[model samples]
Target: MMAPFSHTATGKKAAMALRSQLAQGAKFLLGLWMAGVIVAMFVIIPQYEGLGDAGRIIIMHVPTAWVTSLAFVVSGVFSALYLFRRRVSDDASAVAAAEVGFLFCILATATGAIFAQIVWGVFWNWDPRETSILVLLLIYAAYFALRSAIDDDNRKRRLGAVYNLFAAVTMPFLLFVAPRLADSSLHPNCAFIQGSQCDGITLELSGARIGLLGDSKLELKSLERQGDLVVADVNVTRPGYQVENHRPSFDLASGKPADRPEFDGEQFMLAVEQVDLATGTARLNIEAPGSGLLGNSRTLLTFFASMIGFTALFVWLYRLRAQLLMGEEWLAQRERTYGFPS
Candidate 1:
């Protein structure tokens, strides 16, 4: 009986040692993988057409933002689980995820500011997307503050779990829905993606068809095909600005806008989407800076790779933090029960 017990203990120790070795290997590989992703973000990706080298920040910025949302989702789920099962481990996990999420959120905001300064010539203009992210950071900050304020561990966990769930419920609206709902947002999705704020308006040259794009009135004056390119004469009128005849051009062969003329005294550009010379019709759009950046295959791939790396990093961080918290809780419980020094 003693020999069998000894063998069983030895086998368990061996298994534990193996798992530790495997975890260390995985962590080392993740570090190397993230290093490669950082290198690729700058060296492998091509310069964006409108944004140039400044577009590289999107590889980091978008991923951090995505990981922020994912972390919050994990926190909310664990918070709900703790409420249902009354498990201290679940509470620890929830706290760990929220802390990680908050860190990622700050990174996302910082990178976004850098991108904004390069593209929009300002660090922050309080755009809808920017404002929403700021709000999210504050909500999570309050979550941590609430946890620190409570003296009783049980009450803190219960109250924090409830607050975390509420905060998580608001995450989707603040990050995705609210920003898209704002028509005045200069976000990339508003300009490039279909069914957003700047979907481009169709106008006929002879029918006096005029449409409003943002605060500007646009009317197609003429459409002409010049060799391999199609050009459109658009009459643009802003409320406090002079009426200007903006000639935006498109490439017939490439099926893309060739010349995107900047709006007068503004960073926004006028993009000609389609021009039908035979029917005297044209589609005009207002493109914000950094619009259509992900259209490039290289940029898209690097961006996705960065996202995956950041998400994996978040998972590692969450696990480590949860274990640390659980350990502290165990030590505290032992001290309270048997007067053991914590």
Candidate 2:
């Protein structure tokens, strides 16, 4: 006959094992859904060419926005569950969703900024959409900061739950509802599904249109319609190396010293022009200070800053939830060894 304590232990272990399985299953499904979302964004949607006409912005922007909204919704629900049930699993789920939400928010902001640069002639102008999204990001950022400031688990969980609920309530108003009623702006109010009556635009892409067949002139017109400008009649010259006023040939094509032709740096130049009407002229002066022309190092700084910020966030989350994640793993091991439930 089995002892009563042993029976109770077995039941508890079984319950925990079920919960772990449920969580893993949920995570797996979410991952698969996200993968399908990526395919839709990159492959299925872009085939229309109208979406591609926006230049990858639509894919990045719309999906990130969807993920951001869904993630916060998940976070809020889990927060409420944690508050009521006081379960560490609920808290972990909420925090995980929040982190993913934050990532999507940042991506949405970046893609929006890039689109603004192409369409609005600036990266950020504090338009209704831009300002609201910025505020939303800041609010969630404060949620994380507040969590870090609190040392006690109970306090952190309670405070985070309250903040999450508040943020979730305001999100719809800030992101969707308010944008439509507020003002006339260049930003597209795409969140409202029913009231958006703008005609859907389409772009036709074919082999013949882009000079894969028939005529080069037809291809130029198609390229112009697609917001592309072709460069023609380009003249390039490489500067010559001088030794005591004697000039030596430095081939620009080969990027090396060649004896075929003697070229002088002062007399060498390239005059380039584009044949497309939809494009603007660009002149690159390599000697200009703080110039963003051609190649510049500013983008590298932006990459490193984002990397460090997210790395710090990851370290903070891992340390905060170490015991919970590790404990869940240990419980699973014990269950597998003993059977019945774990």
Candidate 3:
């Protein structure tokens, strides 16, 4: 029969071997997932009107935010389990999720700031959505501080559970409710309201439609103030339609619409008029008959790609954290058994 020490050593060796195998599998899966993410960036993301190249950033930024919220949810759920079962492993799971979630929250905020800078021409505006996300980060950070302040394991776990439960209660209100309290927000939200009506509006030159495809005549004249007026006459074979003066006007091509129709004259004359008016000249795009554009399914692909990639990455990190916590517990137990520091 095996001695007690010998049996214990064998069990440890078996556990380590199993862990090594799992780690290798995780590494392989992560590599494959990353490959797909790259493919989405290069081959799948599409250029749709105003959201052309810059739209690529949308995938990463949104995912980071989503992952943050998901992490908090996980932390809360694990905290609840720890309270109900009083398991040390459950407490470890809750902490791991909270820490990783906080990291994801920071990433989401930073990425969003970068995107906002590019699109809105500013960074760190106190937009309603921004405020909510910022508050969430603070809450998660506080959870960590709370955990650190307590040295007793049982007490810490109990208090942590209660704190996380309170924190979870606030998430829906802060993230979903608070932002929508304003009349309008730069943030995106999907509302399923009863009796909602769409505000009918014409699509602009820089909206949902794709690029202008046609021949154009360009005339540029230099002005005295080192500025110039450009008049371009473009003909589109197929035009998008808009109701102007209650009449369906076919825009074979279109440029940025003026606050009002700035010109009802020749393109060159309008450009000259714009120069004197000190208003920028608008390029004239004349659509022929039926050429408003739509996307080529690339936008959908990009959405899925970014969503899947970010979710996979978040799961990987969360799992890794949990595993490390488990390893720490194992080492602590081993130290006690061996009567030595590991």
What lDDT does the true structure give each of the candidates? 0.88, 0.53, 0.59
Off by over 4 Å in 3: 1-26, 190-296, 333-340
- By summed lDDT, which 10 consecutive residues of candidate 2 come out lowest? 285-294
Count backbone clashes in candidate 3.
11
* TM per prediction: 0.90, 0.49, 0.63
Candidate 1 root-mean-square deviation in Å: 2.6
CA displacement after TM-score superposition, residue 119 of candidate 1 (Å): 1.7
Query: Evaluated with TM-score, which candidate comes out highest?
Result: 1
| lDDT tens per residue, model 1, 283-310 | 8998888787878787888778788889
Give residue 137's error in model 1 in angstroms. 1.0
Give per-residue CA lDDT, model 2, range 111-207, as digits (tens).
9888777655689988777888899999999989998899887789889998998988888887776665643344655322422312211112332
A best-first ranking of the candidates according to their TM-score comes to: 1, 3, 2
Shift in Å, residue 248, candidate 1: 1.2
- Flag regions of model 2 displaced more than 4 Å: 1-52, 190-192, 196-342
Collision pairs in model 1: none
